[model samples]
Target: MPVEMKVLMNHIYEYQKGVRRMVLFTFNQKYEPAVVDRMRRLQLPFLLQPVGNGCLNLYFGRRECLDAVRMIVDKPLSRLTPEEDFILGAMLGYDLCAQCERYCERKCRRGHCGAAGA
Candidate 1:
């Protein structure tokens, strides 16, 4: 799906205001060049990863954050291990409790119920 310009600008505004250390923006692959140009003009560090089906995920933020992401995300987002998913969610500023619940749910589904609060 193509990302809306208003939404992208809102995320950019938040990043500029230090509201988040990183932001993930997904859009059609065709817009890659224009997005790259904007990121370069803004002097933001980013990693553009293809998410298949003519889409791309733009991970923009501190160089360190991107480096961490590079280590944890060698595969598709859907293929991340539960722990890796939790880490990614945390890094993206997701609610900790929700991440924990998601982590536990994923683990439980794999027969590791000891970690699930339920």
Candidate 2:
């Protein structure tokens, strides 16, 4: 249910250790046949390179890059590419949680995944 809800974030909370390399949003699935072409028509800075097995790879060098793409689009989050998913995940603090493994939403401290060995 939460994944399908509206995500209000405008940026990704990247945790880069050194120089900020581009953030990679990997989608394990691909869009519909014409979706890539439609994205191109919008003409944002995103370069949606096609990955094997019907996946899509989006690379972003800065938050502004994503902002530009979002600005020119009016579709619902579900209809957007994997970028939306990354945004929502960052907003929800999916990177880590400070508590239980499966139920908590807080960002995990240290290297623990809140699932013990997980």
Candidate 3:
């Protein structure tokens, strides 16, 4: 191969290597407790990088992506495969809102609801 082509290939390989090992999760400050509980229940390993205001950056091996994604979402943790890893799982979790802000007639915790609790 030409020198320029070799250099280009080497650059691409380096860039891919730089990103292959980083698996991280960022969570809202208020949900830290829930996130931590979820992680503990799953029993995965992590390095917690505490951000200000009770937020955190949880890092783990790339293999732990699915478990990390489950920690932040209101989902039942199912068996995970690499193809269905955290990069996409987190995106799917964001499609629905968390239960903390949700309200309905059945569990009317807010006064403005039409249920008995109103």
> Which lDDT tens digits does candidate 1 get at residues 1-118?
3446567778889999999999998888888788888899999999999999999999999899999999998999999999999999999999999999999999999888873276
- Estimate the TM-score of every prediction: 0.92, 0.28, 0.31
Stronger candidate by lDDT (1 vs 3): 1
**Colliding residue pairs in candidate 3:** none
Off by over 4 Å in 3: 1-22, 62-118
Local error of candidate 1 at 57, Å? 0.5
Clashes of each: 0, 4, 0
Poorest 10 consecutive residues by lDDT, candidate 2:
1-10
Name the weakest run of 10 consecutive residues (lDDT summed) in model 1: 1-10
- Give the per-residue lDDT of model 2 (tens digit) for 16-110: 33233334454544343343453355442444555567666554544575565446334544454344444444533455342233223223332
lDDT of each: 0.91, 0.41, 0.45
Model 2 error, position 87 (Å): 26
Ranking by TM-score: 1, 3, 2
lDDT of 3 by residue, 14-91 (tens): 434654343445555565565566556655444565655665655544445536455543332233322233334443
Clashing pairs in 2: 96-107, 96-108, 97-106, 97-108
